[model samples]
Target: MATPTVEKFLLEVSRVLRERNGPQLQDILVIEPPLPPLYNLMVNELRNAFPSGQDDALEDKCTRALPEYVEMEDGSSWTAFIKFMRQYFCFLRDVNVENLVETFQLLRNLVKQSVNALGHGSMGVVLLPTVIAFSRALTKLTIALHKKPQLIAHLIRRQAADESGSRSTLVDTAADVLRDAFSGCLNDRSVTGAGVGSDGRPMGKKISIYVIANLCLKLYFECDKIRSAEQIFVNIQNGSPPLSLYPASQRVTYLYYLGRYYFVNNHFYRAQLALQSAYDGCHSKCVQQRSRILPFLITACMTLGRFPSQALLRRPEAAGLAEKFLPICRAISRGDLATFRSFFGPEGPHTDYFLRRRLLLPLRDRCEVLVWRSMARKTFLLAGSQGDPGARKAPTFDLHDLLRLTQVLERRSFGQTQKKPIGKTHTNSIFMFQNSQQNGIKPELYVDPDVKGVAEPAGPPEPTMLDIESMVSSLIYQGFLGGFISHRQLRFAIRGAKEKGSLNAGFPNVWEVIKSRSSDAVPGWKRDEVSSVRNGVSRPPGPGMVIHLSGARPAGTPPM
Candidate 1:
């Protein structure tokens, strides 16, 4: 039964070819072919039957042949189908220059309907292949329409869908078709200068390049290949006619995407530079757009460890802008917890939401702020005890305090004393100074009666009394003269040493006699016979006074 049906179909196709006026030609050619060989034969027969000199009929015949072959399920059939369509479309392209406008219009309409059907979930296995065929056909049509402004406008209208409606899926499907078409055209390099310019000359559509780049970027970003998106941006930048060749607004848009790509990849330095350029390139008239750009700029600055420009921060025009970003800077500097929390809040258009939530906010609030606050407290304590007389008595900063603080701030469960003591050398210096003051002593006053009697010849006997209290007071006074110690503490140290007699006992009797003789202007006390007289005594020296009685000095003392 299938063989006879196929035979009857073949006979009808042959009859149409001979008569060339069959009303059912379109219907007959569009019927499903039976097998791979029969499919190829039918396609070849249709191709040969395309009317000569009648370009419209030839295109219609080829167009009608598309739906038939595109329905095949087998891979071989699909491949052959694609090959047949490509050859047929290329033939239409070459021969039907005048009739190309109407041919593309009809083809675009057919594919658009197919696209809509596929989007509505009407087509199942056939959808993918249909998309591929529609894409190929659209590419030829779009290229043909490039020379016809009326046709170009018509195609655009046909392609337009309700952008704000549930048309994204449709747009996406159409975008897929457009993407494949552009890819094919780019591969062949034949689409260049294929479109007609307003000047009525063939020119490449500059807008298409931007559209292609944007599509590629979107595709790559959705796939999470941020690096490839960045590379595409680089290519866009280094193109022969640079991205800057576009108008400022378009250029700004390009830079905007380029900057975001860098930002997403953590290329902060490049991101900052690119975003700054974009922000500046966009005019002030676009306040909303400027607002959108500001956060990215702020983030870029922060990541690069740079502060925002003063102009931006201080400008009255940027009031809301300052409110948005200044807290981020302050939080970073002071390690403030509340500010950090607000920075990562769920309200704004933050780019690195996950990082802020998972890492930066928690780290700052839970760890960094606590660590810095502890350090500040330690510094204040150290500064408070700068100078104390009994430095060892002063409480020193502790290493364990710092280490324990560190553990607490970092949320770690460890408490061990630090190996090195805090301010060790400084504490030691203070201790040594204290010990030296304790060991120091004062000199005693001594007077010799022998020298006192012989000093009558002088106008006045020089005072030989040593004021030990005064001498010790001078030393202690000098030590604490800086007003670091209270007067009561100074007096107590002096009085304590004197009461112990350590101050007076430090002087020797012989040294006292020498001092007394020197007071009386006696030249040599050691050589004088008074020294022998004093040495002869075995008993303890008298408490009141002792005079050395030398015979020669006694006779001439008054006279001398």
Candidate 2:
């Protein structure tokens, strides 16, 4: 005999089954316990019925709500979903919440069952909502696992499902399950069902690819398994529809991860493109989302010599970012190496901030090159011969002149700190100033700027002649300087200064130089021209070019 509460639950399930209401059915069959009185009622019913072996009677009523087989096509999805829900009920009743590892595996198998149904006739429409729900459950499982760091060792061992002979973590295995789900959506063959839309795009279940993909990416990044994320990007570029067809939320999330992938591989140009699109497409009201995108976007922009403006830093999303990046900008602009190193060095105040984002070494290395260019340009402007037509000569500056300017900047940047310590303890200044103040007299101190003829200071060593030459050569080689180093004269001279003026002939714009060398196409980014069919092959979308082989060897030749 069924209890009144058990009978009422079964009646509701039957009603949902008859009306084909997936969301309501999903709500009823949640793996976790329901809220408030329902939770207490379900727990009490399970506790009282299980020990007496009367639970089988209640289970029978749950089973009878949906029959084993339905002759009608409309009942197929319903039948599949109800079967999954019954398993959810069993898990909720029996699962040990304390053992999250075991609990995660149970939920994983349940979601895997849902993943399998994604391929059955038209069941994807019915099971996808549950699939996303279970996946979130798995996410919570991983988060819980992260809190217990000691238990991570247990997760580090290879599971029976992983055949690669390498260890896996809780998040890694969850990503694999989600990858399988993503594949089910990507590989759907149904025409009118969930495969392609009327506009010739991935529709229905296929639209869930990015949703599942974003989940997998989140896990992969957390577990330090970035290489695995690349394969997902490749699959989307090959088969998925243009990203614009998806909702704004999905597009923003996918592009953010894609931009980060490019960034880790040192592809700043591509990183900037993806991140810029993500930032622009994101909703203006989503402050947290915009905040997450700005760090990588700012780093990429700075690498390409485009600094963020003051107005941009004043936005709510950019709070505290100015303190970390502003010093670097001012250092680059003023060509101050000491200030740059003082703020961003290994022992600097902002070191931990940049280190956490993995931006420390890259910013330190790549931005230093721009600093050299600034120093060189400043030296030329101050000392190089002016390109007045009356002079009729190329603009030239001595290497010694640049060396002097660099030393002056370094000394000034570090001078105050070097003198502060000694002044705090020294006798002459403190005694003399205190006596004069007691007598109501003011003391004035002045020193000539040209007093120091030697390069002695309490900081980094001065740049040598060889270092200056190498920096100039590098700038010239990279096309930042439209000039050549005159080794014999130990000077840098612009090629067409007499005709085009010094600034035009000697220094090129940093953005233009970097832009000309960068490729326009980023592999996973979507554009207007990409086709649904992609001409029967998967290739990067953009203008195609050919490579010429030099010194080709004949086929099957064995000699070296």
Best by TM-score: 2
Q: In order, what lDDT does every prediction score?
A: 0.42, 0.76
Tens digits of per-residue lDDT for model 1, 1-560: 02233345545544553453323444433321233555555445444554345445544443454444445444222323233333333343333335666555445445444333333111222333443444555554454344345645654565575464443322234345454433332232322332334654322323234545554454444434456554454443333233444457755666666776766656555666677888998887777777666667676655433557668876543555566556666654453433344445443234255363223443333333332432323432443223233442322233334334333433321111222342334445543443323435321323455685454442222222132223233323433111122234322121222333322321112223323333331110111112323557655543223556674564446865
Scanning candidate 1 in windows of ten residues, the lowest lDDT window is 521-530
- Cα deviation of 316, candidate 1, in Å: 8.7
Q: How do the predictions measure up, each by TM-score?
A: 0.34, 0.77
Number of the top-ranking candidate, with lDDT as the measure: 2
lDDT, candidate 2, 1-560, per-residue tens? 23466557767766765665767767775676444577557656665665334445544555676564334455554344445545555565567777777788888878876777556655455567678878877866776777687766655544555687766666777888889888887776665543457776766677788888888887777667777899899988777767777888999999999999998998999999999999999888898999999999999888888899999899988999998999899888878777876666445778888988888877888888888888888888888876456666677889999988877766765663454343235457544654544445454533346874555555767778898899899999988888888899999988877666788778888888899998988898755454434669765645322334685689998878
